[model samples]
Target: MQKYPMTKEGEQALRDELQQLKSVERPKVIEAIAEAREHGDLKENAEYHAAREQQGFIEGRIQDIEGKLSNAQVIDITSIPHTGKVLFGTTVSIINCDTDEEVQYKIVGDDEADIKNNRISISSPIARALIGKEEGDIVVVQVPAGAVEYEIDQVQHV
Candidate 1:
């Protein structure tokens, strides 16, 4: 099995979701299935079918989370040495050379990448380009739009 990179926070979040699914959602779905079963015949019951399908979905999600957690290699950010170079979990502030727009992005695992939160996956094109780069280094990222240039202004480990 391939070990996947995941941040400490991402691991915890997945664990929390698994816990909720197992302890809460799973039982609720089971109860719903039971209630639906009590309503009518198995052949003609839409409620029973829906509830059973929902149960399958919940169980599948639980299994999926468990598998991911089992394969996760948690990367703790704080323990990493405060190097100026861009690394996983380090935040990079960049300035768009063409448009002069500045944006800060934290390179993180795929599970923790949320564009709204300024966290990007390490596999992302921009993050791939920024890797190993240090402050004051200029980076060019190739995207669907085109190749865009950026100057690394700061790299923060935190």
Candidate 2:
């Protein structure tokens, strides 16, 4: 199996989710299942069916988290030496060459990419364009909206 890159923070987030699933959700679902079972006939019970479905979902999520964690290659961004260039886990500040709009994004693993949080996947077109480029370098990214040019303003490993 291929190993997947993940930031330390991402790995911890997955571990926390797994812990919550195993310690909290699993027990709660078991309790719910037991309570539903006490309501009598398992064949026609809607509560029992709902609880069983929820249990299945929880178990599936738990397994998925476990698998990802096992395959994770946790990278500590803070420990990486600053090279004044874009790399995985590097927070980059860029200026839109056309619009003059500045935006900051952290290049992270696929699982940790959250657009709302300004975390982009390393495999993303913009990140791919930014990688290995130093400050003041201009990169053209191909997006669904078309090609956009951005100037690298800063790169920080934080």
Give me the candidate number with maximum lDDT: 2
At residue 64, candidate 2 shows an lDDT of 92
Q: How do the residues 18-101 of candidate 1 rate in per-residue lDDT, one tens digit apiece?
A: 999999999998998899888879889988898889999999998899989999889898998887899988889999999999
- How does candidate 2 fare on TM-score? 0.97
Give Cα-based local distance difference scores for all models: 0.92, 0.94
Worst 10-residue lDDT window, candidate 1: 33-42
How would you encode candidate 2's per-residue C-alpha lDDT over 1-158 as one tens digit per residue? 88889999999899899999999999999999999999999999999999999999999999999899888888987888888989999999999999999999999999999999999998899999999999999999999999999999999988
Clashing pairs in 1: none
> Candidate 2: misplaced stretches above 4 Å?
none
Could you tell me every candidate's TM-score relative to the true structure?
A: 0.96, 0.97
lDDT of 1 at 108: 84
Instruction: Quote the positional error of residue 36 for candidate 1 in Å.
Output: 0.8
Clashes of each: 0, 0
